[model samples]
Target: MSGQLEKIRGLKYIGVVELASQAARILAEIGTTQDRGTVSEMPDERTLRYYLAEGLLSPATEKQGTASVFGYLHLLQLLVVKKLQSEHLPIRKIKELVDGRTERELERLLGLDAKAGAKNEALSYLEKLLTSPSASSPRSQQFNSPAADMMRPVAPAHAARQSAPQQQGQATWARVEIEPGLELHVRGDYAPPTETKGVRRLTRLLLNALEGYRGNMRK
Candidate 1:
């Protein structure tokens, strides 16, 4: 484990200030700051703290004197989250995907992103989509595409299909009926979850809610 982390620690241990600056620079290279990917702003120290609170980023792995220190793995975690944000992935789901991944896995995800292009390009295109709006990613408004975001596969799902949408490109989309009346509309290009996995998760969540509701009623 120590050796693996050591490999992920390309920038070594760094304080918040340096981490923030370097992360910002990387986000720029990946196009997260673009008009399409569109991250609101570069993350500052305060934002880093927020990420810590939210479980989006890992805790500091080391310390430099009185200061907390983070590693490249942390940076990659942030980048992965930012990339998924472009696909409009929810924070909870993003956490499931980013939280436990290895550095090599995270790097592979970054490399797989259409914007990022390939493995060797590594950091090149990661931040692009993070900054730009989803507009640049051609989509069908409401259809399915190959699971390319394939970076993080959504658990699984199976539900009745409920809509038809125009084609935009290879973008993926989904319509999930959470309950009889409530459903989700996933835009294509979102690297949509397959019906089996997507619906399974949504169904599980609904069941959990219903269980609690029933408990309340019994009271």
Candidate 2:
């Protein structure tokens, strides 16, 4: 029992060290104020400070000389904040959206890939945040609303199609029924059963419709 407990503690320590190493690497490569500003498109120094003050960004892990050194998590937060603001989402709302998440959890939510474009990934990440249960703000337009609840997934009608193969036709737009009425049509010749459109537009439509319908309900 003591051996098992010691092993668990050692593994936890190793995980923390691994995270610290990755954060350090991220900082060493692109942790400068100018670099962060350029990458995130948030050039104003005061704006970064405001985000820090508002608890939108986690504090630096360590300091180098005079300036504070930020980590990969901080970089991720900055990118997400910048992208949300470009969409005209309020700062307070953005803060509300990201609060109470661990660094690793936030990374998972953002779907952060070192190879992917930061802005595009951030935009993609925002959709997931809106749908997430953590978005508990009453002002949150989607998720938990009555109209949002009304839209449900349609189940398969039959168990299987045990019939002869049908003749193939010229490829047309690939369609995906995200909900009963909502769909995403992408112009492509993708093979059958392959994912045609991802959750991008489907997520947007659901969120927009929820907000739109909710406003109408109030009036």
Candidate 3:
């Protein structure tokens, strides 16, 4: 794994941090140490290669080495992809969903916060939070089912509403579609993500909240 990692780090790229070797080691450790949870197996080097080939993991940063180096964003992406895989999501589908999206976008899709800095700490934080007991809700479990069921495009506005936490004394006007037969009214000046960056951040917030909702549903 280390050798393969070293080789990849030798690739040329611009603006890449010089932490290629360290990033590779951290990734390897994560691969080896992740708990199975509901997942069958963790991804290995071969899997990483396939992801790289499929354009799922893009590491285009500057470094002094002969190869391109990866940065915190890349590390976060690897962690997200691995977690989704553990949910038994097929690589083909995962690739399809995330292929064109940037790491910043994927981070938002996974509902990660913007507090992303520090490669190792950020990666560890995401892994710990996503793999904790709360991550095992019915929604996450659904990822273990057939890929066809998990491929629906999420409705942003509705999803944003569904995943938000209700709080008292929040004054704003909001419209929410409850179901085919029912719609609800709320008073709050709630707005969904409209900007490119806002959309990603909103998506991440929704996903995290939705996971909690699913867990609650199972109780």
TM-score of each: 0.47, 0.32, 0.34
Q: Candidate 2 lDDT, tens digit per residue, 1-219?
A: 223222322221112234344333443444332433434443346666777777777666576565576654565576556556655678787776566556544554444434454665576667655564434365652433333323421111111111322322322333444432345553222323325365666556768986697569646
lDDT agreement with native, every candidate: 0.61, 0.48, 0.51
Please tell me which predicted candidate would have the highest TM-score against the true structure. 1
Judging by lDDT against the true structure, name the best candidate.
1
Using lDDT as the measure, name the better of candidate 1 and candidate 2.
1
- Candidate 1's residue-wise lDDT over 127-201, tens digit each? 543333332355631122222223332323211112223434433455544322344556423443468989889
Q: Which stretches of candidate 2 lie over 4 Å from their true place?
A: 1-41, 108-219
Using TM-score as the yardstick, the better of models 1 and 3 is: 1
Higher TM-score: candidate 2 or 3? 3
| Full candidate order by lDDT, most accurate first | 1, 3, 2
Q: Alpha-carbon error at 89 in model 2, in Å?
A: 1.8
